[model samples]
Target chain A: MSSPLLEIKGLKKYFLRQQAFWQKWTGKKEYIYAVDGVSFSVNKGETVGLVGESGCGKSTLGRTILRLYEPTAGEIYFDGEKINDLRGDELLQLRRRMQIIFQDPFASLNPRQTVEKIIGLPLKIQGMKGRELSERIDELLEQVGLARVHRKRFPHQFSGGQRQRVGIARALAVNPSFVVADEPVSALDVSIQAQIINLLQELQEKMGLTYLFIAHDLSVVSYVSDRIVVMYLGQVMEMGPAEEIFSSPQHPYTKALLSSIPRIGKKNPSTGRIILEGSVPSPLNPPAGCKFNTRCFIKNKPAACFHEPPPLIEGAPGHYAACHLLG
Target chain B: MAELLKIKDLQVHFFTDYGVVKAVDGIDLTLQEGEALGILGESGCGKSMTALAVMGLVPFPGRITGGEIIFAGRDLCRLTEKEMRRIRGKEIAMIFQDPLTTLNPVLKVGEQITEAIRLHHEEGDLSPASGRRGFFRFWEDRRRREMAAWKKAVEMMEKVGIPSPELRMEEYPHQFSGGMRQRAMIAIALSCNPRLLIADELTTALDVTIQAQILDLMRRIKEDFRTSILFISHDLGAISELCDRAAVMYAGKIVETGSVQEITGAPFHPYTQGILASIPRLGEKEYRIKPIPGNVPDLGDLPAGCSFFPRCPYGQAKCKTELPPLEEAGEGRQVRCFYWRQIRAQREEEGGIGGELSFAGD
Candidate 1:
């Protein structure tokens, strides 16, 4: 089989914290480990979902993969070529091939620009001009299920779902081979979310595009993804085929996350939900060994979990988890 | 259980520059003493406005145009501002989605809880001439009241499961985490042991695990305190998990009302069916999310007939020109649809909606 379309190896991104004057004089420093030692890959025309809670660094991982924020360590390969260090013209060309759809549609789109300019800006940046650019903008609008008359309307004139469609159109304007959809549907209402998700899947099939779908909602991720990666406190807890992971989640963290979802039609809901002990610990000072040990609901957690970080070991053919108990 | 709150054809209209927006159109609702009734709808569907109208806290330029909010044998719409103030926290209290904005940033968490306690219980102790004539006695009474309130605040903090209530009480809202802040908000709302609690998307801002914790706390509150809850949210999962009965609102009207089980298992209205079909079940292998077409109609300029007529998949000619009153579909179920019987019959003939949405059973 051909190699994957994109792969990441040991990716890490750390943000330095501002220090006090005394700390500076004493030569002390601090860092927030936003994304630590994460590795994953996406095959051609397939979607890989990244699921995590807030402050778990899923968004940071997405941005770091796109080189929007430079990684402090490790490698990112696009079609088997290391693109981490690509600069100047090469970086610009790579950017055209890799685009992102942001979480907040209201904040992502330019309020002042009309739909025409918003979708046309990318093509214009790529050196398209006048009639060709305007025609391309109208085509993109129609592709995303918007009317041609809406091309002249401003962002404020549209509703939430319509604004999100505009955002999706902008991301697809440059015809990127890889797209990172970051919580694209979480901001939308339930009915509207389905519309956008269907639109994304349809566009993926039509354009032969690969996606890294990131969201906290597991149900949405499970619906749209081929494989799922569960992260916590800047570390991957488990990764596997979506059905296998949902059916038999090996990692305690994954189990907790799955069961925490409130399902309808249950006579007594939350009956078997494994309520975590406390909120996620501050990412600034994560736990020593297992990132989830602070809130892990496993019985008789191995003592080594407090000191030694477990390696990601494969359980099934493609299912992998990081936990001492799994070993 | 006795009827704790009853709203009869309640209407709240906002007169704007463009037109009069009927945020909470004429609707009837009732809540028993200990029942948790959920108001389910999308944004701009007037579920929140209904809760606000019941609390007598609708913002300016929005007035209760018609109908009566009979709560505890009095019409809340007819009450004066001063009279409504007395009923707000003591009779009914509301907690919003964002705790940071709802809570005072400058005040300590403990102080906020104490202030809420003082508002309802600080009475009969302050005599007529205590402020002027008996200054010393007034000072003594003030100290006693303050001491009592502080103790009650700590009790409330402990009751809400805050760790180290004594220490955390001194910390401000900024110091607490997102989940902790919500717990503090709940403590303040329940400090007086109000009969009814209005949670307006309280868990929408929280993460999943955190939301589960809050839901657990709310369940415990319902059982221990016997507080009637009017939970308003757009999340179907959360509403079904917490509420005994639910009212599904469309535009400014409640399109359906039934037991939570009936609403999820065998819905009648097309709008309700659309909402159920739109949610992607967790364990379903195939993605069959049948999204309801079109956006929620503009409340300011609604259609001449049914507000949902523009988006209903089963819409017919009669639905376009005439409004359908919410009729009794079953013993206690209600649905606003011209052809619900036909819709239910069609679904039954086409197998069942259950097989499509079945969860991965344990």
Candidate 2:
């Protein structure tokens, strides 16, 4: 088999919480496990979706892969090169090949910057100057369905959907092979969301781009991804092909997530509305073993779930779920 | 079934610096008692404006130009400011999207609920201060009666599933989480037992898990109180699951209105059909998500004929010149389209009931 474009192994990132007054006096520090351990790979020209709830570490995982946040542990490989260990100039070169499309269109771009400056900033940072940068900016703008005239207009002058297109254009300005789209359409309207999704698909095929699409919306993820990864409390609860994850979700958390999606036409038969009990556990004090053990609906959940961490085992070909029930 | 509220030919316009923006052009809607009606639309579609007009809370520079809002057989539009204030929270109450902003920051949760009840009761002339006000208002008997009503407010908090209602009642708004605050807001709105509850995206700001809990709670409370709800949201899936009937709004007009089944199973308007096809569903085979080309028309500078003609896929020559009237299409279905028959025939020819309406690529 050909090598994947991106490979992540045992990636982890922990954030240190603000020291409490007592802890400051005592000279103690506390850390919140944002991303405990995640591993995944994206094949060339393919999209892998990372799905999870708010504060579940999906975004952190994406940022760590892009090296926006330094991983506390684990390795990230891009195009057969160990990128996690790269630093200084070498890291800067790797950044040119990897870009991220942030979630909030309003906050991502500078309000004072014109569309030209916004899209051209990346090329400028790489030392492209004079007419060369302006020409490249125009081409990128047109590629994302924006007019050349819009280059003079400020970010606030455009609508939400338009602003996102400008963002996509900026991400592409670097001509990156891999892009991390972090909930790119979540802030957009439903009708407009389809526009952005279609644009991304078109861009992917045209640009031969691979993506790590992170979003909490399952429907959108399922529609866009070849493979899907479900995260719960900073750990991969399930990972498999999009079709398998949707058709036969093995993890209790995955099942609840799927069932929670309000179907358009069919009557919901399983009134077993699995409302996962309890707000997400504080990341600082995550439960041991399977993080989802506290809310698993299955009656036969093993005692090992609380004491021993369940390894991600294959429940079916190409389908892996971290659950003691499968064992 | 008796109609609880009827809004006819509602027109709301904002007198802006640029021009008089026709935010809500003309809308006609009816809500039956104990029934849930969902207003489905994108932002700037004027769905919220219709609700604001109903509540007599249109912001500054915006005024209801012409309309008849009949609630419980009375035309609310004609009521005086004083008369409407009397009916605002007593007969009708609104729950805004952000519970934090809707609640006063300084007041305790208990005081807010008590204030709602006290206002309604005082209006009904049932307060213990019946007559003697100047010097004897501080009497012990009157003070005891006031305290008793405040205690009842605590009881209302528990009815909305708030934990430790008595203790939590003393906490400020910031002390409660998003879901708990929404529940607190619901408790305050229900204290007067208003017949009609207008919830404007009450769960939109919440996460899906919390949203589900809130929806379930709203469903349970709806069953117990038999209160009619006008649930406004942009999420069609949530609306279809919760609302009995729905109205699809676009460019300040109702493009389609029908029972949830009819709206979801077979939408009649072109805009409605686009919205349904645009959303990607779970477990479905991957296909190119067909977005409606172009953008929603500017409310200030609307198109000549049909407001949706610019982005509509099936727009014809006549569509640009003549406005289509909203007419009953079938049982429990209304559509605003001159060529729905032609579009339906085309969809059939395509070997599907709901095919994407194609537009010429610009």
- Give the residue spans of candidate 2 off by over 4 A: A20-22, A268-272, B122-151, B354-362
By summed lDDT, the worst window of 10 consecutive residues in model 1 chain A runs over A264-273
lDDT of 1 by residue, A247-303 (tens): 999999899888888888887786778888679988889899988888887778889
- Report, in order, each candidate's fnat: 0.68, 0.58
- Which segments of model 1 are wrong by more than 4 Å? A21-23, B123-135, B354-357
TM-score for each candidate, following the candidate numbering = 0.97, 0.93
Worst 10-residue lDDT window, candidate 1 chain B: B124-133
lDDT of each: 0.91, 0.87
Quantify how close model 1 is to the true structure by its C-alpha RMSD in Å: 2.2
lDDT of 2: 0.87
lDDT of 1 by residue, B61-127 (tens): 8988999999989999999999999999988999988999989999999899989888888565322
The TM-score of chain B in candidate 2 is 0.92
